[model samples]
Target: MKILIVEDEQEMLNNMRQSLEQELYIVEAASNFKSATEKIGVYDYDCILLDIGLPDGDGLELLKYLKKQGKDDGVIIVSAKDSLDDRLKGLDLGADDYLPKPFHMAELNARIKAVLRRRNFDGNTLVEIGNVLIDTESRIIKIADEKIILNRKEYSILMYLIANKTRLVTKTALAEHVWGDHIDQTDSFDFIYSQIKNLRKKMDKATITVEAVYGVGYKLEVE
Candidate 1:
């Protein structure tokens, strides 16, 4: 999983990055609103930790921008603001949870897990589709009781495809989701095709198939 932390305070941002990285998430951060806005517009994250009082803009406005763009990344407002109005406005703007600052790291972790559960995996730790079983915590994939080993990028690709199994995941979406900010640095989607080809080979015996849509994108088909 991946996360974006948007906070103006350097120390607070470091703390969040360290804590969430310890939980095995690929973590990235932006200290101000402009940087955060740019990152959010270009990349996709599994979750976003947004602070209300940013240096250049309010975190609530960031949520509104996300709404306008139709991105459904799970958001947890990690603000120093504890007012009921602040919390209510965040929720009304589609934040998954509001976490008051000066909170325990354990509590923050719990809330993030809850949001991810609801948004990504239907409240289950094990993601199963037909014969394939994935353990989100351990990042393990098992097909028909047989274990499979995948490198980090391969695993990320597999999980993203599984998450949007029913839809045709466009190449642009797949690249941005898996590669994050680094996607823009690449010349083409040859890396994406490489990962998808490897993933197809790895799961050849499984009931699911990854199909290319010819000039469009790819779709995961479950036999």
Candidate 2:
């Protein structure tokens, strides 16, 4: 999963980033509203952990920006301000959940899972497409009764593809999701091709198929 942490407190922000990274999520951060808005404009995140109290501006404005752009990235307000009015306002602005400051990492992790589930998997832990099954919590892949083993990158690619199963996923988006933002330093998307080749081999053993769209991108083709 990919996440954006919008916080100004350096210590709290680092803690959240480290904890989420430990859970195998790709995390990025912004200390103030300007950087946060810039990130929101450029990249797509699976979930956003927003601190409503920014040194420069209110974090609720970020939610409003997301709405105006029609981006449905799941958002959780993580702020020291736990007032009823603030909570209500954040939710009304389309935040999926709220976490007051001074929280445990475990609880934060759980809330993120819940929000992602509600937004992406119809509020279910297991995501099912035809006969393929993915356990979001366990990170397990099952084709009916059979289980398939995949390496980290392979697993990430598969999860991303499944997340956008109905749409065409461009090479740029796929690279950014699975390999992080450093992809801009690389010269080619040849690495993606290799991963896709291997992923297709594994998928062929199962029921699901990933179809390449030639020069454009790839899409999930179910049988």
Candidate 3:
């Protein structure tokens, strides 16, 4: 999973990066509000650990902005504030959870897992679509009772498609969700088509169909 850590203290940020990276999570850091805002505008993160106190602006404002943009990324406030008002305000602003300073790294990790579970798997450890089952915690995908090994990008594509199953997803949406701001420099979307084709060929059951919409995009149909 990808995570963004927004904290002003350089030492604290480094510690957070080390702790999260040890758990096999891709970590990115931002020291202030401007840098955090820029990162949020570009990358697609599964979770964001934001400090409520920043050099330029309040983290709650950033949370509100993310919500306004209709981004469903999970957010957690990791600040030194432990007051009732602060926690309540952060929660009201759509924070998934709040952690005060001097927290154990293990506890933070647990909270991150819990937030991800609620956001992506409906609090279930496994995500099942038809005959395919994915263990979100284990990052394992199984098809027809057999385990299937998939590359990171392939797995991400499958998860994104399954998350919005039965909905017509445009190429631009897929690119943005997968590649974020970097998609703008790409010359063509043929690579997206190829990835979808490769994913379909790996499925054991042919019941699920990923249909193209000609000039638009693709939709996954279970008919």
Candidate 4:
């Protein structure tokens, strides 16, 4: 999954980013409101950890901006403001959840997982498509009732494809989601090709297929 963390505190932001990275999530960060607004305008994320107390602007306005644009990106307000009023305001403004500051990363992870589940998989941890079954929480995949193993990148690629199963996923989007900010350093999508090749081999026995669109992207189709 892809996430954007908006916080002005450098230490907290770094901590959150590192913790989420260890969980295999594609994470991006913005230390101030301007950067956050730019990213919010350009990309879509599975969830956003928004800190209402930004250095440049009120984080609540970012939430308002998202609502104005009719963006459905899941938002969880993470702030030091623990007042009931702050919580109500954020929820009323369209945040999916409110996490008070001084919270555990485990709790934050849990909240993000909950929002993603409700928004993407209809609150189901198990995603079944064709003959492939994925337990997202456990990060396990079973094809034809047989468990299969995949490397980290391969697993991430497969999940991204499955998430966009009904649409064509552009290479840029795929790379951004899997590699996060580090994708900017790569010159081409050769790594993606390699990963796709390996992932396809692992899923060769499954009813689902990953079909590449020449000069474009890829699509997940069922046989």
Model 4 CA deviation exceeding 4 Å by range: 123-223
RMSD of each: 14.4, 13.2, 15.0, 12.4
**Where does the lowest 10-residue lDDT sum fall in candidate 1?**
102-111
The residue ranges of model 1 lying beyond 4 angstroms of the native Cα positions read: 123-223
Query: Candidate 4, residues 1-223: lDDT per residue as tens digits?
Result: 9999999999999999987887689999999999999999999999999999997899999999998989999999998989899899999999999988876554576568668888997747898899999998889999999999998888988887776664567787788767875786788887788899999999999999999988578888888
* lDDT, each prediction: 0.84, 0.84, 0.81, 0.87
Tens digits of per-residue lDDT, candidate 2, 15-120, equal 9898787768899999999999999999999999999999999899999999899999999998897799999999999999988877655457657866777877
lDDT of 1 by residue, 73-180 (tens): 999998897889999999999999998887655456656876888888764788889899988889888999999998998887777677556556677667765787
Output the number of the lDDT-best candidate: 4
Which stretches of candidate 2 lie above 4 Å from their native place? Answer: 123-223
Q: What is the clash count of model 2?
A: 0
Query: Distance (Å) between predicted and true CA of 62, model 2?
Result: 1.0
lDDT of 3 at 43: 84
